[model samples]
Target: MAKKSGNAFDFGLFKRLVGYTNPYRFTFYFVGLAAVLLSIFAVARPYLLQQAIDTGFVPKNENLILEYVVLMLVVLFLEVIFQFLFIYFANWLGQEVIRDIRVKLFDHMMLFKKQYYDQSAVGRLVTRAVSDIETIASIFSEGLFMIFSDLLKMIVILGFMTYKSWQLTLIVLAILPLILYATRVFQKKMKTAFEEVRTQVSNLNSFVQERITGMKIVQLFTREETEYTNFRSINEKHKKGWVKTVWYNSIFFPIAEMSSSVTIGLIVWFGGLRAAEGDVITLGVVIAFIELSQMLFRPLRQIADKFNTLQMGMVAASRVFAILDTDARVENKGTIQLKNISGAIDFDEVRFSYLEGEEVLKGVSFSVNSGDTVAIVGATGAGKSTIINLLNRFYEIDSGTILIDDKDINTIDLKSLRSHIAVVLQDVFLFADTILNNITLNNPDITEQQVTEAAKEIKIHDFIMSLPDGYHYNVKERGAMLSSGQRQLISFLRAYVTNPEILVLDEATSSIDSHSEQLIQDATDKITEGRTSMVIAHRLATIKNADKIIVMDRGLIVEQGTHTELLEIDNGYYKNLYDVQFSTVTE
Candidate 1:
């Protein structure tokens, strides 16, 4: 874990940024060389001017004049070439670094336990992935290069001026300390302003994304005016943030420009006086000092701009680090393989909690034999799905061991454990792709024939065939083109295609029409014929044929046995749930 930086401004962002350049060492070296050549060319132009004035024009040497002009052109062309090469390679390196970071961020997000997602908004993650990467990429591609080139130019120009004439150099250097102090002050203010802008932009993104995704709900509630009003308020905040950013940027550039101009004016006055006093300061040297003075201040302005940019990157870096450094709540200690064995599951003295003080499941124990269908029936929030989630090891339990075929699940590899089970959740998500690709999930090795077969077995093949492109039909984002029932069928086929040893259906058929529900029921019955399966549902009809039914209330199993046995008990919880469904069946 990174200890928080005591100061609001993170000086450490530079260190982290530099670390990303490790992979592109060759690019860095080449860019550094190019920067050197570019700075050298800048200093060379001033000297060329000095020579042309002192020797060529004074002596009326046409050949020297022509030679110097041609030399300047050649140096200018060379500088452009080097600049192009530096930018090309630097951008390539920066993009590659950004790509790696984005991938790492995605992988890290996955490793974070479900609770993180429960609290974090989609827009925030999207911003980190897209905008944050962009900021860092800009820092790498342009910001770092500007900094390198500017620093090189500043040092080279200053060093040359001092070497040619120390007295003038000392006089020019008088105001540099003041310039540095002013730059520091400007940077502090600009950084804060930009940071506020970035944060507001993220919030605006979140608000927009949430509103768009839930637009139907908003309309149904007749809250369009309210949403619009809220949106206006956020937009106002965004406008304020943007205005502040512009205000700071506007002030920063003018101050830097004025400071540079003032330094040049002071240099000219003092240098001209010294020359007039017969101080042996040639017109050529004085001209060179003027040019060098301008060159020196250009980089100072660049540093001011880059300081603001670095602030945004640093803020993003801290967020990225927060994610990277977070501990994953789900622990995967299993490495042992459980292959081609009987699928028998046992939950022994299990205890689990999502919150610190509120236990979701306490001392729950159950045994499921191979090929047995166990149904878990409960009210909402009664820990039915939680039991199945544990079976897949989506969340680690607080205590007690879950066993598979008498082997503790902790001893099995996570991949192997998950590979042996398939889950169909209440809400199905389908990627935006061809129907076939969505079903296969880009498993290239899975044959098209197998894909069709899976779809057919789940009774979705005819519907897919009715589409103009059949299996090649593209699913809209999140399968928006399909009805909920159709989407659920595709999801079932996807899970079935995996041919898992264990199947978990969590309220899988609750939201579909009666006919679609029957189809799902048929598919479920066929799929679970010889596999270890657990069904968590509110409808008693869905689990009537289960080998055993476990009824839960308030995180504890209130009743257990066959459907008839639970109905016979006639207790409030299970009896009420069964009576509702049983009455519907009778009607």
Candidate 2:
């Protein structure tokens, strides 16, 4: 059983959410004023009817009756106008606030540390940004002003009832305790039910999103029946959550309705008897109190339901605020901007861990001098990718320091640090856009001529020209339209076009055809000519000519030297790896 957010209303949460309305304060106040006017005008109807009956019927004055009817019509017209204003501007205010909140939330998420995402679900974040924020919008359009209007209308009706006849007012007020208790019970029940519904919604979102994203794997492994069963189970729980809310509504609404009906009946019976006995309760008063009883009790019934909506909004608001409150981000406090850097990188006994007490890089030390190409080779999980992630400032080091050209990388501006280094990853991802946009990432500074020149330098210009629309070709999602090797070509061109001082190629040539491999090989050779390059590869043949090689095992560097020099050592780690891999290639 999951915990439900209760206390129905949270004043602190309310105030914080209301702060978003500061920019649209005029609309906020206007809607509030409209609610008040609508409430006053709502009470005007019963009074006008009471006057029309007592003055126009008992006194037989047709002209006054006509005047009261005309006044009623005018008030109705005003109520309609204000109702429209209340609804329109309230929704407008909601949209504006959500727009600002969504943007701010997304901006905050964009800066979250990589480690934060490692443990978070993408679908859950999507819900917060999309549906959950929409729930907060209901706070304005349906919850806040509607509840205020209903409560105000009930108050004004109560005042009129007491003024007309205190006896009838007491009869109506007698049902108050019963209805209030029912509302409380209904509220608690509904709160838990709604929490389950929201939880199931998030679960469904997460399940569906991941399944759809990995549909290929599902089909590859013939998991259609199994996945369908899993989906049905989740869907059933989602249905059960909603049914519980419906069941609660079924019980509560009729009880509320019966309470209202009994109060109205008591008003008619008591006021009629007193009027017949020639007391102060006149026929007009009886009729008016009946209408007033409805106006009062119906809102009491509705206020319960509207408050539920308000509670859900607050629950959603709390979720949204939780994300906004997330402070997991790489702190960028360095004021020193990096420029004209020599691309000299030194890792001074750097220690790091993705999880506490589980060190991935333990006191790893290495150095890459300016204008040199270095290759790092190790089996999987040797902290190879961790090094690149740290260099880009995606994650903070657990201990030790990394220096760039004698200056600490932590002291260099994060944005400027990444700007001067272009990392070409092994898994190339391209957007669903034109080949040109994918290469330049819509950067206005990188023109077609520059891209063409860069493409020609890497010898991929002929390949781009061969495509159906040339550089204007749409690659579809994740470059699904292009082959793996072709996508790598685009990635190389993207990296080279930036012309960064340092290049980190993370096994970019793996898992491709022989022709594509040679083409990428040629592009790789061309790009690393004058740049400080760090090449991570499992294919030892590819990096045999590298100026230096760093061989690592389990989180520690075991060997460092040129390929020939390391191979010359008897029983060395690099020598063993070289012998095994070169034999497999020969076989």
Candidate 3:
């Protein structure tokens, strides 16, 4: 329930959203013209009745009566036609504008860095892209028509009533101030109710998503009853919020209906007396005034109904604007270009913190010579992964610099910098697509031969060919259909296919079976042959053949040497880790 404060609906955002409608402005203009024309034609209908009653019917002029009826029928038909056209265009215009907004919002969301995703919730973001856009879409579709049609008809009827009988018009309009006051009060209450409902919806969505994703864990921990109770709590909150909105609407609509009925009764009674006394009121004028009063109150009923949707639109607009306003924490201002690289990497006084007042890496400095394999080993949260994040520029360093082939990383274009790095993560993420697509990651430009060669080099081609569909086999979400070993193998092939200048193997074989680990080790050796590689290994066996080993503790490099060199030290952390791994293997 974040508050939407000042300048949230500023002109800048409105202007940008409005720019989306520029393509359909001409059609909207036609809708406006039709609205005006329909309003004029509608006003003429009551006048036609008035004229026929006072002149043609009273005198028994058959030809004049028939002529007026024919004219009225034509006007009625024209009004209906133009009304349909107006609605058609307005709906068409609104939908297209909404489509444009959704596409732009999604595109912008994709361009944003991982930091933004970390800070935002999935429920709220989906609500904005979906519910909020629909709210705005309603404004363009039916809301605009009701606002224009009702307001214009009210204006025309009011003007005509004043022209025909000024004294009576004044008497009827005295209750208008009361109508406006009631509308304002109901609108304020309804807005608050709808806002509460929107919050409840987001909460419900979050609970459902969290529970479904972690359902297996809930069952394993015997927390089914607890989770059910929690889910019921969220559901009850949503139901209660909905009931409150219904209660308010139930009361408001009846009040509007009663007030309108009272107004109509007063107009009819007063006008009847005036006509009987032979004053300015005539039979025809009296009838027309009654019709005019109904027209005026019709819009009032509509205005009441539309208040709910208008408030919903405002809330949605606030959400959408918030996302569009997110500032990028990672910026690429570098103009340097490097088409060919030598795979050398250096970290010069690099320091970083995920948040303020808590530093993760302090004065971390290291260099990997061209085509060298370096292992970074430490206990959990020693800033091991943070070092690779800096190398890939996923997150910015708080201070100091990382360099690639002598060029400061911040001085190179970000896309090009990342393009030269290949990352094989331990947690594999495969799309629900063909095995070929999963290996190539839907990158159409990657040739089939390149995919096959990468798979063969990674020692997975033979295994894939044994499967029913081979490369055409479908991988479920997160590679759920494949074994952990198979998923890891595919990830290895994916990484090697890029043939990157630098390789980041982030505990890449941590979860694989022994057989798959050996295959990955072979693939790793081939891929890292001419590339500078940084290995973050929890398994000592994986990095035993590294050219250099750096042992870290509390954000500092406590020891650095070859594995054999580190093993020779009697009390070093690396020696202790190697001894522990050896003990486990022997046991």
lDDT of 1: 0.81
What tens digits encode model 3's per-residue C-alpha lDDT throughout 1-587?
Answer: 22543222234544565567788878878888888898899789999988887788878888888988998999999988998898888788878987887887887787677767777778778878887787877766666566777788889889999999887688678877777777777777766777778888878877787788778899999999998999899899999988987887787677777766786787678888987898778878888877877778778878767756656666666567677777764688988876779899988998988889788998998889988999999888988988988888888888998999999998998889988998888788888888899878778889889999878876779988888799999877767788888888888888889888889998887788876777777787777787888998766565787999988888888889898899889888988877776446521
lDDT of 1 by residue, 1-587 (tens): 11243233564666776787898888888988888899999999999998988789878999999999999899889988998998898788778878888888888887777777877889987887889777877666777777788888999999999988887788778867877877777767766666677778789889999999899999999999999999999899889987986887687678767777787787788778877787867777889898998889878888777766766667676667677777875677877887886889998999999888789999898899999989998878899989988888777789998999998888888889888898998899998898888878888878789988887776767877988799888888889998888888888888888898899998887787765776777777777879998998665556788999988887888888887787787466677887776557631
The best-first sequence of candidates by lDDT reads 2, 1, 3
TM-score of 2: 0.96
Local accuracy of candidate 2 as per-residue lDDT tens digits, 557-585? 99999999999999998888887875476
Error of 3 at 585 (Å): 3.5
Clashes of 3: 0
lDDT, each prediction: 0.81, 0.89, 0.80
TM-score of each: 0.95, 0.96, 0.93
Candidate 3 deviant stretches above 4 angstroms: 1-19, 277-279
TM-score computed on alpha carbons, candidate 3: 0.93
List pairs with backbone clashes in candidate 2: none
Clashing pairs in 3: none
Candidate 3 overall lDDT versus native: 0.80
Maximum-TM-score candidate: 2
Q: Against the true structure, whose lDDT is highest?
A: 2
Off by over 4 Å in 2: 1-5, 583-587
Count: clashes, candidate 2: 0
